[model samples]
Target chain A: MNTGASSTRRRHSGRIVTALLFIAPWALGFLLLVLYPFAASLYWSFCEYDLLSPPRFVGGANYRRLAHELLNGEGFGRAVWNTAYYAVASVVLSVLAGVGLAVMLSWKVRGQAIYRAIFFLPSVVPTVAAAVLWMWLLDPGGGLVNHWLTAVGLPAPNWFKGVQEALWPPDWWSGRAAFGSKDALVLMSVWGVGNFMIIYLAALGDIPKSLYEAAALDGAGNLRRFWHITLPNLSPVIFFNIVMGVIQAVQAFTQVYLVSEGRGAPAESTLMLSLHIFLAAFQNLEMGYASAIAWMLFVVLLAATAALFHSSRYWVHYQGGSP
Target chain B: MIHDKATFRAHLLLLSAAVLFAAPLVWMLVSAVKPAGQLTQDPYSFWPREWRWQNFADAAAAMPFFRYMRNSLLLAGGTVVGSLFSCTLAAYGFARLRWPGRDLVFGLLIATMLLPWHVTMIPRFLLIKELGLYNSLAALIAPTFLGDAFSIFLLRQFFRTIPEELSEAARLDGLTEWGVCWRIVAPLSKPALLTVGLFQFIAAWNDFSGPMLYLSDPKKFPLAYGLEQFVSSYSDQTHLLLAAAVMFTLPILVLFFIAQKSFMKGVSTTGLKA
Candidate 1:
């Protein structure tokens, strides 16, 4: 009995050694890359630390400036509105477009593989290349989109160059700048909804066909069956997508930086929070201010995510329990 | 008859959407070979009046195309090696073992995925510079060798699906934990490992800001950043720009075509499970 207990203790210690050895890479990374950076950024948010000099304590000044900009709708304020608008608009549109495409692709067709390949091909193109291609396509003068619009006798807006918005045009809104830079970016994003479509397509396959058959026997039409049967079953997936879409949309940077030439040109119209943070820290050397803005954005994201979870109870139906 | 009509409508909707999505790529290909003068004179022409295939030669010659290609390949290959090495080990630990605080640590890993990169961008850059890695590709590639949260999670999920009986049998045969992880678990998890490598490769390939931040020397620029420079200088020569863009984008498309099954599987599994 005594020997068995000692052997058990020895075995437990062996497992410990093995576990530590295996996990050391991520453990060290967590300490250096994640833990230290997290604490340092939090502390630096309260200090004036440019890269060249030691950090000096500057309590609340950066936050004050962010607040001032938020009210005046300048630096951070304009970015806040732009980020909000883009995140909401892009998520909603991609959901609609992705689901629409997924539903269509799920139908039994002659060339299903061909159609799926074609739809997924565009997304495989790298973002920088995609941005460059879209830039030429959406150019206000002599571009393919504008050329077609003019050919159809519709107004051609200066995309990537114009500051006007289609959703909330200002009082001085002219028909000329009907669609603007953010609108153009949103259109470009929807073009690459292939990832979302693939996910939704997979989920659509998992829905039991028997449910549809029963619904049809109960005198349900196609639209009714889709609304009552398809959507409820798919709500959990849609919710997952909404959460991921928001996070990705918030982190969206490369395309925004590319189209705006890194300065949010044409009246700061494309200045997203991510790009704003980039320019502030790297370009202007305002590390303290950038850190503070990052903290604020982080807090806002956490809050928005919490709100989404809170509201999801009313809508998201998990057939098997919490996903 | 009704089902036939519905199917026809679905085909019509799908065909129309495909045309809309495919038009930009088709335009890029056609634009790449257009006579340089036709762009300014007849920019709206749907097709090139004459295919000046010379534009492809011009695009390749106008920049250090081969040099940039080499840099891109090096960067992408380095990341694939680094991430696969680290993520597989960490995943085996998390999936196949039981230790105190293990579940808590795994939860922390999941939480870290939601923390936006901007929050850590500044200090991380400073950390790299402090390590004397500024203006070096190591600054970009070294951190990936440590581990990535998303890949680790994906791999951990895959490892858990592996049978524990194999690992136990290996242990009975005097295999150490490292041997079990690398020999038994890693080989069995090749598809997931390939998925992780594919993902890291694509990310390193698409990464614009990393090179933009850390790399300043023109000699070190990858194709993604180099092509941007090409655009700035030769913005007027749309033919050359389009040709270069097409060339830059082709490798990724070809890779996707070759790995389409695994690539689609990776995406769907991550999406559905998450």
Candidate 2:
């Protein structure tokens, strides 16, 4: 009995050592890549440093400039508002569209696989390439869309050039209509909604045939079944998708960067916070300021995730709650 | 017969939606050949009055297309091998090993998924710089080799689905733990390993940010990053730009076409289903 117990302990210790060895690489990378930089960034956020000079710690100066001088005077608040607007609107629109399409596709439909492949094609398109494609597609005047619109006696708005116009034009939009305020970015983003659509489709597939069958037998119609059985069942996936979407949206750099030609222009209408951070860091060489913005973004993402998790308790239905 | 009619209606609806979804891709292909004037004059027109086959050749010539392809293929290929080796090894530890803090460590990996990439981006860039890997393909490939938490977690979940008896049988036959994992478990994980490889291939191929951050020489750029040259170049040639975009997209599109069903099946079986 004593020998068996000692052997068991020895085996357990060996397993522990092996496990540690397995995780060591990731743990080292995480510390060096993620944890250390995070701490260093926070330190730099309070300092005044370019790459050339030693960082000078100036307590509250960076924060104050970012908050008071910048936010109040130069419409930094508007940029914040724009990011939030884009993030929330894109998440809501994409999620709804994704879920709706997934449901539509989930029906015992023909060519289902083909439909999925088609929708998912855009998701696989490289970001830079897709952005280039959209720049031509969404060109304000004399583009394909405008050409069609005018041919049909409709007005065409200058997509990239125009600002201060409604994103989606009304029925009365005519030749006098103006282009929207960086709404072209929004329009292009919707095309890539295929990513979330895949996730939702997967979730929809997992909604168990029995649940839908039971609902049908109980005289629930399609919409009714969707609401009670499907929606509730899909809540966790929805929650996951939303959080991921929000994170991605906040880091919306490549599209905006390439689209605006890295100027974040069209009256700075498309200057997403991520691009703003990039410009500050790389372009302007304001590494400290950019670090500050990076930290701010970190805080915002943390808050958004916390809020989602806090609210998830009310909505997201796990098989067994609070595991 | 009625059931058939309903199925037929569903097919029609599915086809219509698929057409709508595929419209942009079709537009992309058509626009690539479109005359510059026709592009602006009739953007929605599917039929290009003038075909510009040279546009693809020109796009290819504008950059080191072959070089970029080699770099992308190498980066993606290395990422697949690295992710498979590391993720499977780590996942085995999580799935089968008995250890203190096993769950805790796995939880840490999962939590890292929620930490925004922006939070880690600059730090990772700095780490790569400090490691003296910057400007080398090693920079692009090494970070990927560290293994993604999501991929590890995914393989771990798949690993858990295998019965414990398999591993026990190997142990009874005098196989060491590592040997059991290699000889027994690895063979049983073909579907998952393929899925992880496919996902890594697509991701590493599409990634513009990593190469953009690290590589400086345009020749060293991956196809995705190399294609950015057309946009930033001093040319207003929309035809050439579209052609370049088409060139960059074709491999990934073809890849997706080949592995898409398996990829979709894998996703459905995994966390996406959760």
Candidate 3:
């Protein structure tokens, strides 16, 4: 009995060592890449640090600056408004467009696979290339979109060069003013709505056909059947898309950076939070201020996500149990 | 009869939507071959007056195109090798091994995925600089050797699906844990490994922000960043710009076509699971 117990203990210890060996790379990474950075950023948020000099402790200074900017409509204030506008507009439009496209694609039709493939193609285009392509397409003059609009007897907006004052002009407001750079960005985002559409398509596939057939047998029209059955089944996926879309829109940098000429051109109309942080840390060399802004962004994201989860109880549908 | 009519109408609507979705890509391809004069003079024409294939050569000559391409390939290759090696081992540890604190560690890994990169961006840059890897390709490639949350999670999920009996039998045959992982589990997990490899490859190839942040030298720029530089300088040369963009996008498009099944499966799985 003593011998068996000793052998078992040895085996347990050996397994533990082996496990550690296997996970060593990730363990090292978690320590250096994640944990250290997380702690350092939190600490730096309170101190004034540039790369050249040692960090100087300035408790609440950074936070006070951010608060002042937030209230007085400075750079950070502009970024907040821009990010909120972009995130809300992009998320709402993409969800509506994605669900609409998915429903259309899910219909029983010939060449369905081809249609799906074509729709999914744009999302695969590299970001830089997509940005470059859209730049030409939305060129204020001699661009294809404007050319088409003119050919169809419609007005052409100076996309990427105009301001947002004309997005929803009142009927009494009659001017030749065009949609602004952010509107141009919205158009570009909706063009890449294929990624979310793919998600909706997959979820749509998982809904049992029996449900549809049952509704049909109950004398439901197509609209009624879709409204009663499909919408409920799709609520979870729609919710997921909204959350992810918000996160993505908040973090949208590369394309925005590319389109806005890398400095939020056209009167800072396209300055976003991610770009603002990047410029602060790298361009302006204000590491401490950048850290503070990053923490604020983090808190906002966490609050938004929590609010979503709170509200999800009222609407999100689950098949088996509460998700 | 009513259903048939509805299906026909749906087909028509889908066909039109497909055309609209594909129009920009089609425009890109057609415009790439248009002469510089035609682009300005006859902008609305769908077909080029003459196919100026020489525009590709001009674009290539305007920049160090081949050098950028080589750098892109090297970065993608190195990142794939590093990610596959590190992530697989980490995944095996998390999935197959029985050890204390495993569940807690795994939860931490998942939580890290949600932590915004901005929170770690500055310090990570400083850390790489401290390692004396700044402005080098190594600065970008070295991080993958550590591990990634998404790749590890994907591989761990795959590893858990394998039968335990095989590993148990391998262990009873005097095979060590490494042998059991390498000889038994790795062989059966080819699809998952391929998914991770493909993902890392595409990510590295299309990575602009990394090269932009780390490498300042024009010689070190990958195709994605280098092409953007080209755009900033030669934005007026619409034909040449279009050609360069097409050249940059074609390889990724071809890769997607060749691996469409795996790509679609990976995308759908990640989406549904998330």
**In lDDT terms, how accurate is model 3?**
0.89
lDDT of 2 by residue, A131-242 (tens): 8877776676556667676788876777777654453344234545555545676666667787678878877777788987888899998789878988988898889889
lDDT of 3 at B255: 88
In the range A1-323, model 1's lDDT, one tens digit per residue, is 99999999999998888898888998899889988999999999999988789999999999999999999999999999989888988889989998888888988888988889888788778999999999999999878899899888998988899987775544335554488899898998888888888988899999999999999899998799889988888888898889888888888899999999889887999999999999999889999999999999899999989999998989987877766
Instruction: Give the per-residue lDDT digits (tens) of candidate 3, residues B34-65.
Output: 99999888888898899999999999999999
| Candidate 2 residue spans exceeding 4 A from truth | A1-7, A73-78, A152-154, A165-182, A208-220, A317-323, B1-16, B35-44, B266-274
TM-score, one value per model: 0.97, 0.90, 0.97
Residue A171 CA error for candidate 2 (Å)? 13
Task: Quote the true-contact fraction of every model.
Answer: 0.76, 0.52, 0.79
DockQ of 2: 0.51
Q: Which pairs of residues clash in candidate 1, taking residues 3 or more apart in a chain or in different chains?
A: none
Query: Which of candidates 1 and 3 is the stronger one according to DockQ?
Result: 3
For all the predictions, what are the DockQ values? 0.67, 0.51, 0.69
Worst 10 residues of 2 chain A by lDDT: A164-173
Candidate 2 or 3, higher lDDT?
3
